[model samples]
Every structure is written in C-alpha cells, then in structure tokens.
Target: MLNSEFIATVEGDKVPRKYFDGRGMYIYVQPSGAKYWRLKYRYEGLEKTYAMGVYPRVSLEIAREKTEEAKQLLIQGIDPNEYKKNQGFEIVAREWFENKKDGWKSRHAQVVIDSLEKDVFPYLGARNLSAIRPPELLTIIRRIEKRGASRVAEKVLQRIRAIFRYGIQTGRAKNNPASELTGVIKTQKVQHRKALPIEELPAFIQDVKNYEGMTSTRNAILLMLLTFVRTDELRSATWDEINLEEKVWHIQGDRTKMERPHIVPLSHQAISLLKELPSYPSKGYLFEGRKAGHSISDKTMIHALYRMGYKNKATIHGFRGVASTVLNESRLYSVDVIERQLAHIDGNATRRAYNHAQYLPERETMMQWWADYLDEAQGINQVGIVGRLKGLFSR
Candidate 1:
C-alpha cells in the first residue's frame, strides 16, 4: 500500500516514527534519516514485527511485493517472523552439536561429527531446519542403507533425530520430522561374536597351541578362555588385580561392562599360564603390548584368530560362549553359579545389590571343574587339574 512519493516525502523526526502505508505495513523513519520498510501483525494475540528491507534501495513497489508475500504467509497461519528466524539445517545442527559434544566421550564426539559431515550435511545442510519433511530424511537414511551400512544408517538416523529435537526445543522448528520415521528403516540383524561349537573345542584348542603368533597374544587367548572374561577386561588386566597366593583375579567395576566388580577363581592351569607370562617391572598390565606401558590391542587377538584359520569360525569372545554352553551342558553347576562366573546381570534388583558374592563358594568348585574340562579337551594331563573333589555328580 506504500507509495513512492509519500515514502520519499517522509521526513526524519527527533525520534523514530512509523509512516503508515496501511494494513500492517509502514516505512520506519529514524532520527538519523534512515528509512526501513517493516510489517506489523498479530499472531496468537502477540504483536510481531518483520523487517522487509531498507529505504529507496528497496523501492516502494518492491516493499509492497514483500509485504503482500508476508500477508499470504500470515493467511496460511504461518508466523513470518518465526519463519525468518528458523535457520538452515547445517547451522542449527552445528549449534546442537556444540551444546552436546561436551557430554560425550572424545572418540564418540568425533564419530558423530564425521557421520554428520559425511552422511547428512552434503544433502540437506542448506535447507531450512523446519522445511525438511519426513520423506526427505528417509531418502538420506536410505542412501546409507543402500551401501549395506545398515548400522551406520541407524546411527545417522539417531543423530538426525537428536538434531531435530534440539531445533524443536529451541523454537527454531515447529515439529520433528524424524519422529515420523519410526519403524521405517528395517532393523539390522545383530551379529554375535563367532565361537566354536562344543564338539569342535578339542580341534580348536590344538589349533591355538599350534598358532605362530606372539607369545603374549597366545597367552591372552588362553587366559581369556580359562577365565571366560570379556576380551577388553583380559586385554586391560593389571598384575595387582591378580593374587597368585589367593588364586583369585579381582576386576574392578569400572573396567566391567555391567559396572560391577567381578572375581575370577584361578585354577592351577590359569595360575601356571600367569607364571609363564614375561614380566615388565615398569608396567602393570598382565599382557603388555609391544608399545611401552600399554596393554595388547584388540586387533592382535583378532588377527591371530584369522591367521589360525578360524577367521569366521570362531572369535576370542566366542570362548565365553563355548565355556557357557559346555558348563551348562555338563550340569555339574547351578545356573546362578555359571552366570555369576560369566558376570552376567541378575534380574532381581535387590538380589543384585546383595548377590555380588552370591555364588562364590559354588563358583570356585565350578571354575575348577571348567578348567579340568578344558584340560581334558586339550589332551593335557596336568596334575590337580584332574583331581577329584566333593559332590562331583550331585545336582
């Protein structure tokens, strides 16, 4: 509704004043002689102002056009001011990342940034945060799935949802489009670590003994099988945690996945293996890596298994599964005793708190039985390994 003559004729005042152009549009004249085209409107009973442009640079006709466009947006129930404030996906996503990265581990934070840069930013980075619809995000995730990286796609989807949630909470976006994508991507099947079947244990044990890898890696594998502890726990084991006289290996809660302390009863075989391990007086690890003061890398064990021709057939972690299956099949121990030795969670909360040492006595017997079972399986005739004990056949 603004005219060029009236806009040009509008004089500066002592204070900023609006020269009405009719219907929520005006030319704001400042005391310093600067004029700006602005629109005033009510949205949800709250008054909001949107700046169209500056002075004659934005001619009366151009200002009128912008005002009409804003009116059309208002008619559609959109708040023009909010629409203008909503930033692009990349901008808002980086903001969200900055706010959240502090709480994440350094490696985890790096992975998230890499995922966003590689998978998300290239396609939809410049698009408005609120303007991107659900189907569009589905296309992005499906691109990752097409490469057979279903797990990466799932993680990318999670990151996208988190970014969208941040945008919504900050009032930059009205709704979460990613939420509409629930159940859209097919869940990837989880692949458990490969372990040998019980019947194949004897042959596998022979292959391990015949392996030509480093003695440290070999010891790691044997100790892992003997203790049935997690691979990382074995890799990071310190000498102080093991008491050769007590025949016990005590792992603290922080190192465990369940964040609970675990005690492993060492059999004579395990004790002999520990004694055979070469010592570094300066280092604390039971299995020290080639690098000074560091434990063995996970890849060392993995590649050792591959070189032993058990690449897909078995894993170091599979030893736990092998032990669990064989122990349960033997029926010489109770489920709680086996599970306690395995360091698995107890379902009952009250029991879990008090049951830290629940089956320690039975576990001692069960661990010795398991070690003897492994000795016989490997054709080793070590003394005390085959020594008979109390209630060998009782339920």
Candidate 2:
C-alpha cells in the first residue's frame, strides 16, 4: 500500500486543494506545484490527521511509513495525533529543561544551554520522536568526548535522558534512546585536591597579590577564595545581595548549588575588599563582567594567578579547599558551624535543620586571619584602604 513513485510524482489533481488517495493518506498540491503528504485518521471517533512533512523532503515511501505508524498507534488505543506530537521529544525536552533551570546557578544554566545547542539540537533536533536511536545518543556523547570535554559529554547525556523520560510520560517519544546509553562512556572521576595548608598560606598570598589583572577581577577572585562559595554564586553576585552592616552576603537560591538561599557572614576582610572596588559605571552587580549584564569570566582569577607565577601550583577553587582544611583542622568552630559557614549541607537532621547562621565570632576572626595572611604574602603592611573600608562595616 505504501509505494514510492505514487507519492513521489505529483500528477492528476481533481481539485486545486488536495485529496486523500487511499489508506487515509492525502496528497496536497501547492500553488507552485510542490507536493506534500499528510495522513488522515481518526481515534476515539475523533477526526484527526498528521502532517507527514513536505514532499521530496519526506519522500513517498517515508510518508507511507509515517501513515502506517500513525495507524499502528491508533490501533494501540493511542491517539495518532498525540503520538505524533509526542514523537518530537526534543520540543518536550526543551520545555522541561527551561522549567528545571530556574534554580540552576547562572553559570550552570549557560553551560547547559551551550551544550544542548551544540550537541543534541544539531543531530536530533528536528528528528521525529520515533527516529532517535540509542546508538545515536552514544554517538552524540562520543562526539563531546572526542572534543576532550568528557565531563560535559556525560552531563549532556544525562540531560537528554531526562528529556526522553519526560517525552515518555507525555506520550511523545516511544522509547528513551538515552536510557540504553548507560555505562557506554567512561567519565573521569573529579576529586578535588585539598588546598595547600594555612601554614603555607602567607607564602601563597604574597605570590598572588603581585599578579596583575583588572582590579575588579583581582578583587573578585580574592573574594571567592576568601568566601569559598561556588564559582557562579560569586560571579553573578549583585550589590543588593550584600549587607556591609550585617557583614553578610545573602546569595539567592537560584544562584546557589543547593537550590536554597544561603547567608554568608562575610569577614571584615572580605567586606573591605568589596568596599574598595571602584564604583560600577552603572548600578547592579557587585562585580559586573565586561558584558553589561553577565558575570565576569571564571578564568579571570586563575589567569591572574598564572600571571603571578602560581600556574599549575594554585587554583581559585583551591581557596575553598584551603579554607575548609584550615578551619576544620583548627577546631576553632564546631563542624556544624564551619559547615554552615561554608554553605555546605550535611545529611544529618540537626545540620539540615540548622536554621540560624553560625560561626560569627570565629568566622570573623578567621576572615581577618586570611586577610592578614594575604597581606603578609603580598608583603604589604595594610590591606584595602583600612579606615575607608571598615567605615562601611556597620551598615
């Protein structure tokens, strides 16, 4: 019943419109003589038909296959139109992605968006629901892997699978091609190296302050190292998020890794750094990127360090590692207090239930100590326009 030539060559037309030849498949004639195939069908006694795509682009044989597939779904008690819509899993997946991304950190949102655009959308963006195969998913991930972004490759696969699962629930995709792709690719384990000890911290700080970059970037990097918040939370930080008086930075939930708001009681030292930053040409983010609205590049700080000769030896993230190491080893604050100050959540009930911020006294002291360390390393006796910075302290 599904023939190629019959659907391919457009000939006799009884009307200027279109006509269903047989088996409920219609041949549509255009003003310019282009032909298109559509399948006419009914489900639950409701009349419905599906666009089989344009002729030549969707050949006669392909149209027939699509028609038969629709009929099969109808026979299976699923509305063919519904199934056809569901078949375009990518559309459903994208909708799902947007909905879930509301709480993702800004940096994460950008990365995920870039990954989907470059990898998934190109190969399978327009493919019908029934078309994507597991082998195809493997190939897509392998392509990302070949580019040396193995972690990103695996993450893209996970997001794609989430979309397929959504498609299955909505009756768009038949089976998850991504579901069968488990264990197909090997991902390198990410083990964060502990930061070099506080004992060696002064030496490290002196090394860093000597490096050169835009003053704002240098300040932002030092702040991140001191605060130990996630990369994104720091970069997307807004002026409104700070309270120099309260000595805290309330990172909004959307920018936090935990998908919950965090209150960072900034040490006097950190606040000093913020206060010393030049007034923004425009008002908004604390550290606005070169772009009007976006945050500064994550690499800016690391590059600063590299220029200062800490290349391959120190990292911006290492600041957190160092902070966690020193504070925890010193036992200056309870594990809970340090964890909370660190904006880290532990699985224990009490820790999770810790509603009030802790470690105020000790954190203030540690922050000062960290600042002193950096000053010592940089061989500077004073830090961040002391009186001017401290004046903004109470508010």
Candidate 3:
C-alpha cells in the first residue's frame, strides 16, 4: 500500500522504477523525476498497459478507482482504452473546459459549465461527438428560447461551437454541427443598462446617502459611482491595489474586462470614501463577504439599489452610463480623456498601447471634477467645478 507521504518522498534514480499497488496498477518513476500512473492488464490472452494519468495530479485514490473501472470493463468483455477513444460528448466537453478554463475568470468558467450541464448535457451529452447533427442541437436551443431566455440560448450555442472546435482540434470530432446553426435562432434585441437621468441624479444621490443597509454595501455603491469602474473590479479590489498617497487604484490586467492593466485617478472624495470603508486598512479584499476570505456577492450592490426603491429605474452598472453622459454633456473634458478615465478600450490597437497613461494629468483633473459633481449633487455645496457644470445642464 502507498500513502501520500511515501509518494511525496519518492525520488528518481539513474534507472527507472515501478512501484506496484496490486490489481495491475502501479506508479512508474522515470530517471528524469517524472512520475506516471499505469495499469497493467491482459485482454484476450494479450498483455497490455494503459496510461491512467500523472501523479500528484492523478493521486493514488483516483488511480485505484481507475483500476476498478478497468476491471469492470474487462468483466463485461470491453476494452477500457477502446472506450476512452470513443468517449461521449459530455466527457470531451469536460476535458476541453479543464484545458481552457485557466485563461478565463472563475465566475465565467462556472457559468459556462453550469449552462452546459443544465441545458446541453441532458440531451446530447451521452451521444457520440460525430453522431450529433444540427437539427438535434437546435431542438435543445429552441427549448431554451421557448422559456424566454433568448440571450442564454445564444450564449449556449456559442459555447457548443467552441466545444466542437476543441473536439476537432483534439481529433475527437470530425464536423461541427453547432457552427451552421449560428443565425438560426431568435436573438433578443440589445438593451443598454438603465441609468438615472441627469435631472434625477440629485434624488438618487440623496437616497444612496440615506441608504439603510450594511455600511460596506453603501460604501461600495459610492465607490462605484465615483470610480465608475466595473462592478467586479471594484468589489474584488484588494487593499494593496490602492495607493492613497499616489491617489490611484492600480487595477491588474487579469481583473479588467479588457485584460490590460488600468490606472484609475482617485478623487479626493473617492479617497475619503475609501478611508471610511470597514476593510480600509485590512490586508485582504476591500469588501469581505459573509464567507471568510471571499469578496462580497455580486448581487450586494444591486440588491441594495432595489431596497432603496430603484428596482427597474437604475442598476449598479448604470452608474458608468450616468458618468459618461454627464461628462460628455458638460463639454469640459476631451473625449479621449473621458474614455481613458472610464477604461474604455480604444478601437485602434497601436493607439491603445500608448493611451493608458497618456492623459494622466487631464484625467486626474477630470476625476476630481466628476467626484465634486457628485458631492454637489449630494448637497455638499462645493462650488468650483460643480457649480459651473450645474449651470451648463438643467437640474
């Protein structure tokens, strides 16, 4: 019997070694310090070896389970290797997800797998990759559309296409049935997020100031309004990312929607709000959830808005739209500066490379002005930039 401690301590020698665990399963160690799990078996009077997987990745327990599964196949007069070669769609999709999930955010990866399990796998999962045709896949998509989830239906189709593409690259599939069905489904019209009109901004600000929820949740809404960064970027922010002396929030590339590093010029008001947060001086995430070591749930800010009576009238994301509208309407800042401050990606690749920090000074001024605008709306009565901007627009 092999224990994890013994396996962890095993070292390679000049010659390769095999440690058997009985029932034809063993760990093979190479001279190069590589360890692999293999199963030795006999089928039809011929000796064969199947490569289970590599260790620590494939632990001793999983290797034993594979051994039992192989024995069951042998009892039923089937070859485990043959079954693996002709694996069903579900198996291949899961393998593809594991291979590709490293590049995606955790939340997005979960959504992809959940969609496949809920709407895709029940019908087509057991079928062979090559056997599933366009019509059969369409039926499942139509079922989703019938339930008024046209957007989800479209996303499911896109995932199926990507899965089939992975299958072909891995030599597990010949043709992609989902490719031809792209435009066949009914897609819902694009609806922009609802933003409170500029006229209604003062009242919304008052409601948020008077919000009676968790103090952290209230601070989150205020931060989002001030920074206008993406919801995930703000909520998942760590204390180390903030440089109070530098007046900046350095968002790492992995956290941004554009997958590029972004610099936010924090306003005086934004800085004051940050100092008042419960986790301001903490070493971990800015907003700690009920679960230890995790950030607050994505629904926290939105649900806070609902409680404040802004159910369909506004959204957390809507704050970005409101800021853009107010800034563009104010005509006090350049388009490029406003866009860069908002972290909007530039369409031109060459220009985008150099534009992230191009307008730092102007952006600092604009961010401060925007923050002051919000403060004035909240009845703080700062009259420098906010007073001028207020005169430019009604209410």
Q: RMSDs, each prediction?
A: 12.0, 8.8, 14.8
**lDDT of all the models against the reference?**
0.82, 0.71, 0.85
TM-score of 1: 0.51
Cα lDDT tens digits, model 1, 204-276, are 7777888887889988888888999998789988887888899999887756767678999999999999998
Local lDDT at 315 for model 1? 84
lDDT of 2 by residue, 1-395 (tens): 53566655656455555757679898788756677788777777777767888877777667777888878877789887665554565677678778878876555577677778888888888777666778888889988888777766877888898888887776666688888988977767786744554545655655555556677787787788778887767877877788888888888775566667887777767877888877432346778667876668767767777787777777777788777765565455577677776777787778567656565777666666655645544553334333322333333
Q: For model 3, give the 10-residue run with minimal summed lDDT.
A: 380-389
Number of clashing residue pairs in every model? Answer: 0, 8, 0
List the candidates' TM-scores in order.
0.51, 0.63, 0.61
Instruction: Name the best candidate (by lDDT).
Output: 3
Native-to-model Cα distance after best TM-score fit, residue 289 in candidate 3, in Å? 5.5
**What value does the lDDT take at residue 120 in candidate 3?**
95
lDDT of 3: 0.85
Worst ten in a row by lDDT for model 2: 385-394
